[model samples]
Target: MDENEKDRILKVEIDVSGKLHLTPEKKKFTLIYRTATEVHWNTEINTLYSPKPRDWTYLEWFKHIIKVTKEECYCELNITEQTEWVNIPNELKKEITKAQQWL
Candidate 1:
């Protein structure tokens, strides 16, 4: 599996009836959020326009469960948090630029 596709942000989906839906076989998990935005505002609210609403989406990806073992103990995890970051090394950046014909 592609390492990039192995990771994705997770969120819980709860119905109006106050029940959670989860399935490990389908890589579906749940996360409870305390608060969220109900609307959005533009850079300048000079015009008479209602604020843009907020839309939350869950990313679909296969989850990989790995077990970490040390001489002292073992740790098990079923859920993983996808971090938002990509730091390319200086040499890699140069290669990417050349490949894209920007250099």
Candidate 2:
């Protein structure tokens, strides 16, 4: 990514309500916000930044959950009653893999 893109990503804001506000370049959508939630770490990272689950970090897990929540928010039909928690979709695993590259 270019410097401009990196800067944009760095500027992402979390409002008082704990929502990530991202505005992608050249995207028609003006405001793309995702709710931010706490992610628990199974194992703490050592001084070298290594953990038992090397591939999955707290930020990665947060991104995965946020993406799923965004999709649910955009769903047309509400098949089930809305709840405080969400069910992470299996397909999101693929997306999480792709996100790891950029993140």
Candidate 3:
């Protein structure tokens, strides 16, 4: 996937009514959250203009699931696992930029 898509995935948040916190599937990138009950409480479905308020993020939704199911839940995503970033000295950055200008 492209960097933009990766960034988007990193920022993805969805509310679900299932036991699973977040399930990433195909179709570009789909996160399926399953709660104990079969009822769907997606905040996206209740848009801002809708009668219901759209105030639940994925974390909030998951918390609701925990309240209803009373099950221990934990989800992890290593977004930066593939990339490492370190501070670069200003002089080194200038040198790198100068070198790039030659190419």
What ranges in model 1 sit over 4 Å off? 1-11, 25-77, 83-103
Tens-digit per-residue lDDT, 19-57, candidate 3: 222221211211223543332323532211111224653
RMSD of each: 17.9, 16.3, 16.4
State how far residue 95 of model 2 sits from its true place (Å): 17
Task: Highest TM-score: give the candidate number.
Answer: 2
Could you estimate the TM-score for every candidate? 0.18, 0.25, 0.21
Model 1 quality (TM-score): 0.18
Compute the lDDT of residue 41 as modeled in candidate 3: 29
Arranged by lDDT with the best first, the candidates are 2, 3, 1
- Scored by lDDT, model 1 comes in at 0.22
Tell me the lDDT of model 2 at 34: 24
**lDDT score of residue 75 within candidate 1:** 22
TM-score of candidate 3 to 2 decimals = 0.21
lDDT of each prediction vs. the true structure? 0.22, 0.29, 0.27
**Residue-by-residue lDDT tens digits, candidate 1, 12-38:** 222344222222222221211111211
Clashes of 2: 0
